[model samples]
Target: MNLAQRINAFQKLGIFFKQFSTAKIEKHSNSEINTLFFDAFKMQIERAQEFNGWFTKENVLKAFESWSEALSVENLIEWTSKYSFSKNTSPKTIAIIMAGNIPLVGFHDFLSVLITGNKALIKQSSNDKHFLPLIAKFLEHTNPYFKNKITFTDTVLTDFDAVIATGSNNTARYFEHYFGKYPSIIRQNRNSVAILTGKETEEELALLGEDIFQYFGLGCRSVSKLFVPKNYNFDMLFKAIYKFNNIINYKKYENNYDYNKAVYIMSLFNILENGFVMLKEDKSYASPIATVFYEFYDDFDNLLNKLNTEKSDIQCVVSNENVVDFVKFGQTQHPKLWNYADNVDTISFLLKL
Candidate 1:
């Protein structure tokens, strides 16, 4: 199939999933679509487990479910329209450096490249090889022609029309020095933080756990730190999330939990230690293992000044209102077909390219 055909086919798959999710399909007689996805996902998880103990089936299902919901057909179409990639005069190539923090963490990049009728050179994270290949396999089954477009490799970074790299803040310097010659989106280390005005209800606080504990708090979009008004109680938050004690891997997480706790104790740092989580009074934007750094705010002006200085390391501030220009921390790296990393507007950048 041609590039346009591949893009249209992938778009159709996205649309099918959306319709299936909302029970919007007219003939509910066929439930096979849902089962097919589940079976595919199960196979992917089994394959991924061969790589490491971290890629558990339960987590993989959760991640896929979330992506399926977020990338609805209508939303996908809306995002692609904004990019105008389908209407471009010349086709382009996109190189993606995917992150392995969460299952299918690089889905957005895959979706963008496919829907835009461009070839994608994907460098799969060692942590994410199995799941993506499974997705590619399933897509190929859906349409055999896509087999060539979604090429996966560990090392394929050369002569690309554009580049997108996600890594630690320090790695950004390296990516810029290396891939800077081309139009690139280089993301540095940034942590997501939440703001508490001390008025959150029990339900809201529980939902906040979804932002924190989901994916084992591994993604850049995960809340690594938080800002709160002085004297905010932790009881309400902990009590709300205590139900999820089983979700955590006790042995593995405890090792990290103990290591960081010991380091903090030996260094005499002012840290709060809960059985499952740790809270520290630190100025750093990122937190330690199984922990989140928090700072007390006396005034909003002081908070703003502090935020301005650390804006480069901060990804998003989850608040009731839109506190910063960047998307909420949880929303970073979660572009549809149009949104790009580093908060870059994909349409404008691609059009110029």
Candidate 2:
């Protein structure tokens, strides 16, 4: 299909996703997509946790809500306008190795390949295998050209022109060993962090709670660490984020809380807890579930330099500070279409192939 046709089809697919954006999913005949896929998708969302407990209905819905907003015509047009697509360019099959940490996590790479008029050969993470195939079916219904544009397999990939893979550092080495010779964009583990000036309003800190707790902090975009000024009273942050205490009700998260709390207690690590999430003074950015690491910063400039030095290990930074390309408080999980993961522009990389 041509670029305009592909964009039109995806915009319709976004409209399909909008119906599931909220807990109160509504069905309507605004278009044929609703009647065709609405109930099936609802069933899929309900059963998602059976496959992966982390895919709670609310979290899955949050992902849908984010993608719905991201796929709006304005957003899509603005994202694509910066790229030039040549209709006559020969299509290549781009293999994508998806990460399953959160619902539909690798979809951005899939979208990037397809939007540029290339075919996608996907080897989905077993943890997140259910959603995309169904979505691909919806896209096929949205436009016929997508009928053979997407393929999912469980076998070793040996027939793609290039690769875009996301995985842990261990799996990354494997991907490089196997796909190294080909043009590729291979991603490794990276965590997001929040820089707190200790002067944030309660409303802003409350929003920051979303950054920390969304997707149970499973996605790379989730904030796992905090950079705070020295002598900072975490009470302000705790009180602001208290509303999310309800998250403890989820069994998976609660088990993590209990286990991590025990580990901290036994290790004699000083930690602050307010019944649900725990805060430990840690120098690392990737914190375990139910715990967020906080490091005290003495000099702001020195801290910025430290972050600059470790930029490769960090994803997006959530801060109001004038850090270049920093994400605002709650918006980390809701990245725009152009907010490429690991700051690697997937579109630009795909265009080169």
Candidate 3:
């Protein structure tokens, strides 16, 4: 298929995703073969949580909504406008190793490879095995050209020109060792942080609660740490996030809260807690579930320098325009199509291959 055809196919796929993007599924009148796929996909979404505890209906819908909003005609055009696709060039097969941390987490890489006219050989994480394949089926049905272009394997990946892999810091070392000879983009563990200036309105901090509680704070884009000014009041932060206190109603989340709270109490570490979330003074970027690590900064200049120096460990900086290139509060998970992971341009890298 040509570039226009590829874009159209994904645009259709996006439309398919939109049907499931809400608590109540809404079918578009013009959707392709909706009778064949729509109800089936809904069943898959309903059963997703049984397959993986983290894939709650609410979180799955949030992911679908985000992708639906992201895959508009304007977004597809803007995202792909910069690349030149040569019709005469042979398309390569790009292998993708996806992380199952969140629903459809590796889809951008999958979409990038296919949009660039390269075939995709995806090795999906066992924890997140069901949803993407159903979408792939919808794409193939939308356009027959996609049939030969997509493949999913559970075994070791093979016969691909380049690779894109996302995993933890430990798994990254394994990826680098195994895929080192080939051209690759291997992503390591990176966490997002919020920088509080003690000036954010209650509304903004409430929005920040979405960034933290969404997906139960399992996503890399989820803000797991906080960088606050000295003597920042915990009362305000706790009060702003009280709306999400219901998150503790989920058994898995409540278990984590109890466990982490118990560990902290046993260790006699000072922490601030409401019923659902806890904040502890920690320098680490990655925090445990049901907890957000925090550290106080005395000097804004030093904080900026420290964040800059440790950029590799950070995926995004959430702030109120205090830091350069920082993501606004509550906007990290809503990254635009062009917002590449690890700040590595996936499309540019795919174009080179």
Taking all chains together, each candidate's TM-score versus the true structure is 0.84, 0.98, 0.97
**Tens-digit lDDT string for candidate 3 (122-182):** 9999999898898889888888988999999989898999999999999999999999999
- Model 3, residue 71: C-alpha shift (Å): 0.3
For all candidates in order, the CA lDDT equals 0.68, 0.90, 0.90
Per-residue lDDT for 7-111 in model 1, tens only? 556554554444322222222224555456655544555566567555665566566555665656566556655544545556677888887777777777777
Whole-model lDDT for model 2 versus the true structure? 0.90
Error of 2 at 147 (Å): 1.2
Cα RMSD, model 1: 4.1
Model 3 residue 197 lDDT score: 88
Candidate 3's C-alpha runs over 4 A off are 30-32
Indicate the worst ten consecutive residues by lDDT in candidate 2.
22-31
Model 3: lDDT of residue 246: 91
- For model 2, how does the per-residue alpha-carbon lDDT over 1-353 read when each residue is reduced to its tens digit? 68888888888878778888665787756467677788889999999999998999888999898898888888889999998886439888999999999999998998999999999999999999998999999998888789888999999887789999999999999999999899999999999999999879999999999999999999899999999997898889999999999999999899999999999999999999999999999998889999999999899899889999999999988998877898898999988999998888888888887
Best first by TM-score, ranked: 2, 3, 1
